[model samples]
Target: MHHAMRQPLPKPTPANLRRFAETPVARKAINTIKDQIAGMRWRIQRRDGNAPAATSDVRIHILAANLDAPNPDDSFRSLTEQVIEDVLVGGWGAVEVQLTSDPQRPLLLWPVDGATIRIYAGWSGDAEEPRYAQVTPWGRHVDLRNDELVYVRLNPRSHTPFGLGRLEVAFETISWLLGAQDYAARLASNTVVQYALWLAEMPPASYDKVISWWQNEIEGTGKVPIIANLPAKPEVLRFGEGSDRDLRLEWQRFLIRIIANAFDLPPLLLGLEQDVNRSTAGPLLEEAFRTAVVPTARLYAEHITREILGRRLGWNDLEFVFEDLEIFDERAQAEIDEILLRNDVLLPDEVRLRRSLPALPGGWGGLTYTQRQMLIGGQRSATGDQ
Candidate 1:
C-alpha cells in the first residue's frame, strides 16, 4: 500500500535552493548531482596500476557482526555484500564486520551454490569449550568450506567480550583485500561508476561465505593477506573522550527526533535501541562516548532505512544536505573554513569515536586456528583436541 504521509526527500545535494527568475541560489546548495560527478572524477583521477581492477577471474565475499551482549548470530548482510562484489568481484574497497545482531536474531544469508566455500574466523569466548563459546555451521549456513574448523577467542578477566573481537578479525581480512598491491593499481584507478555499481552488484552474502571468498580471492596470488591481531582482548565501555564523540551527540539528537515522532522514548533508548527500543542503562549520563554507542547508532540507522525508509523518503519539503554523509570528504578549504570559522560546528567524523585500525588481515602464516594455536598451546592430541 502506498502510504502518503511525507513526500520523498530531495536527492541529497550540495544545493537545494534552485534559482528562480528572481531568486539566486548559491552554487553549494544544489550541487549533489555535481558532487557525485566530482566524486566519480576523483576515483577516475586516482586510477593507476597500483590500485587494482573491479573485475576478477576469482571472486570472493565476506560478512561479520557485533553486539553488546554476545549473540552467536549477528546479521552480516552489508559486510557480506562488500565481500562478494568489492573484494571478490571488484577486488577493491573497504568493509566492516560486526557481531551486533538486529533484534537478537542470527544472521543467516550465505554459503550458496555458486559460492560453496566457507572460511570461519570469529571469537567464541573460549579456545577450549564450545559451551563457553561455540561455532556452528548448522544455525544457518551452507558449510561450503566443509571443514569443521572454528576459531575461538577466549575471554580474559577484563574483556569486551568475543563478539567485538570477531568483528576486528573480519575487518582485518577486508582491509587486506583493499590494500593488496597485486590489484592496488587497478583499484585506485576504478571509475566512480565502477565502484558504485560494484557496491550495488554485491550479493547479500552470509558470514561463512565471506571467509571462503576472501581466502580464495587471495589464494596462490603470491602475496598472502595479513590478519592484524587485536593487541590484547576486547575492553567494553572505555568511557572518556573517545571516538565518534561528536557523531554520537548528533546521533542522540537524531534518535530524539525519531522518538519525538514515535512512542514516548528517551534519547538514550533511541540511541541504544538497536537491541531493545524498550529499556534503560546504568551510567547513561556519561559525557564521553562509548564503542557500543557508535555501533548501536549504525544499527538504528540501518534498521530504519532498510526496514522503514527503504525508498519512501520525502524529497519535496526535506532537502537532505549531502554534506551530512560521513564518508564524503572531498571538500574545498574555503567551504570547510566558512562552515567552521563561522559556524563553529564539527562534522560527523570529527565528532564520532571512529578509529581506523591497520588495514588488512595479519600477514601470511596468519594462521587458521589449526595453524595459530599450533605451538602456542600444546601438541595435537589423537582426538583433534589441542
Candidate 2:
C-alpha cells in the first residue's frame, strides 16, 4: 500500500555519497570508526535493574548464537562493519531476518544494501504493517514489516523519512577536495611550466620548425641541449604569479577537517595531527569516541533490542549492548572502578561485568568489599558466642 510519496528534494543520492566516501580522508575516517565498532563485543543481557542476571531462555541462547554468526556468509563483526559503512555513507542500514527450520540456530540475519530499501513516507499506526519495501533484482517490490527486518537510520529528521548521511553534509567539500587533487595530478603529469615560449618577429617557417622541434623533443621531455638557439631568441613570457604553496596541501587539509567534523570525529583521527600532542591525544581520542563511536554503537544496540528482541521474539526482558563501550581508557576505567568499589558504589560482580571478566566462584562477587568484611567479622563473633 502506497501513501503520499515523499518526493525527495534535491540532495546527494546514496550513489553519490558512496562515491565521495571512497576518497582518501573520508574512507580513512569511516574505516577507523567502523573498525572500532566492529571489534567491540556484543552482549545480550537480561534487564534486571542493573543486576547481572544469567538467562536460561533457549530463544535467548539461540539469539546469542545467531548474533555470533549471523549467517553462513557473514560473522557478527563483518555484518556490523557493512551495516556501519552503509549508515555512514547512505544514512541507512538494513538487515533482513531470515527464519530457519533448524532448532539450533533458528534465525539468520542478512545485511541488505540500504539503496535497495525505500522507507514509506507515511507509516501506518499498526506495528505489523509494512513501512518499507525492497526493490528486487527483477524490479519487483517486496514489502517488509517492522519485525521482519531491522532498519536503522542515522541522524533522522522530521522533514524527511530518510536519515541524513555524514557524507551528504560534506558533499561539496569532498567535491572540492577531489577537484583540487585532480588538478594537481594533471599539473604533475603534464609537467606544467611557469612560462611559455614566444617566438618574437620570427619567420613563419622558423616558428613552425620551433614548434615541431619542441613537440618532438623538448615539450614533455624537459629542456634539451640546443646549440646557439638563435633567430629571434624565442623569449620566455611568464604566464602567472607564483605562490608559496602550490600543491593545495593546505586546502586539502582544511577539507579533510571539514569531512572529519561532518562525521563527528577529531581531525587527528583523519591524520591531521599538527595540533595534537601526546598530552592531548588521549583526550582527543576520548572525545571522538564519545561524540562519534558511542552514539553510533548505542543506536545499533537500541535497534537490535527493539526490533529483534522486543518486536520479533517477544523478549522484553532482554537487552542488547556493546561491551566495554565507555570512552575511558583501561587505566582510567580501572581507576574509576577502584574508586567505586572502595566507596561501595558498585558490587564486585558489576565491576567484573564491566571489565568483561567472569564472576568469582561461590557467588562471592555479588557483595561489596565492606559487606564481605562485615560478614566475616560477624561469622567470627558467632564462633566466639558458640
Candidate 3:
C-alpha cells in the first residue's frame, strides 16, 4: 500500500471562480460539446519581462505539443507515465502541459513540483482519433476516462491559435454571430433606452412608462429631446427641413430606445411589441442593423452560460469558473496558438473547464463536459447543487 497520499484540491478563489465562468462567446458555441469548467483551479504562471527570460531562480515553461513526441495511441502514454513517475513525481518538479496533437515538439512537458494536474481533451466529432495527452503536477486521475484524451503543451504565445482558433472552428456558427458586421456596430441612444428595456423583456408597466414619457413630451409640442451623444459627424441625417440638432437629437434618442427594446426581446417565445412609428422606430431599426451587437450577444451568452453551468450543471458533478484575461501572445507566430508564451489559458472571462486542470498527460487544458462525455460517458448530476 505504498502510494503518494492524494494531494489536497486547490480551493476556489475570486480569481478561480471567474476563470470557470465561460465567456458569453464561449458559452454559445461550447454547446456543441458537453461543458465542465466550474470545479477546477488553474495556474497562469509567466515570466516578468523586466526580469530576464532565463535565470537560475526563474525558469518559466508551459505545456504544448512537440511534433517529435510519441503518438497517444501507440507509446506516448507510457512515455509520459514514465516522465511523470520517473521524472516529475520522483523529483518533485513543477509541471504544466498542453494536450493536443501537433507536428513540432509534439508533446512538450516539464515535470513540475505543483500539487495539481490539468488535462485537456476535446475532439470535434469528425476527429475520432485518439487524443494526445500530457501531465503536469500532483498525480493523475483515473476517473478521467476519455479515450480521445491527450495532453499538449501550450505556451502563452500560442494560446489564441489553439484555444480560440479551435473555439472559432468548433463553434463556427456562434463565432459567425460575433463577427457579423452588424452585430459589432455601436449605437447609443438614451431614448432607445426605453426600447432597450422592453427588448430586455421588461414588464408591460416598464413599457407603459416609456410610452407615457414619449406621449407626454412629443405629444404636445411635437418635440423630443436628444437622448444620447452622437459623433460630431453623424452618419445619419434628417432630410426634411426643421430637423435641427434638437430634432435630430430627439430622433437619435428615440432610435436608441427602439434598439434597446429590440435587444431586450429574445427567447423569441414570449413575443414582442411591434407598434412603433417610423419617426420613432426607423432609427431604432437602422441603428440596430448598423451596430454590431456582438457585445450584447456576448452578454446574453454569459447569462445563458451562468444559468446552464451554475444552475443546470451545478446539480451535476460539474462546476465552472469564469475567468477574465488578456489575450496571450508570442512573437514569430502569425496568431497566438502555437507560440512559446503563457497567458493562453488565461481567457478573457474564461470558465476553467475542470474543478482544476490535471497533472496527467490528459489534463492539458482539460475537456468541456461534452468532450468528456464523448470520450467517456458519465457526467455530474444536474440536480445536486444549489
Candidate number achieving the greatest lDDT relative to the actual structure:
2
- What are the root-mean-square deviations of the candidates from the true structure over C-alphas? 33.9, 6.0, 27.6
lDDT at residue 345 of model 1 (Cα atoms):
46
| Clash pairs detected, candidate 2 | none
Residue range 1-386, candidate 2, lDDT tens digits: 01112323335767678777887888988887888999997677777735446433566567788899989999999999999998888788889987788878877899999878987777776887898899975799999887778988999998888887777787877777777677667555656665777888877778777776667677656667363455687776865445525556788799888989998999999888997889999889889898888988899999989987787778888888888687358788888888988888888887766555677778778888898889999999999999
Structural similarity to truth (TM-score) of each candidate: 0.16, 0.89, 0.17
- For candidate 2, what is the lDDT? 0.79
* Model 2 TM-score (2 dp): 0.89
The clash numbers for all candidates, in the given order, read 66, 0, 124
lDDT of 3 by residue, 187-280 (tens): 1222222122222444454555555554666444567634322222112233334224423444333433332332222211112234555575
lDDT of 1 at 56: 18
Q: Higher-lDDT candidate among 1 and 3?
A: 3
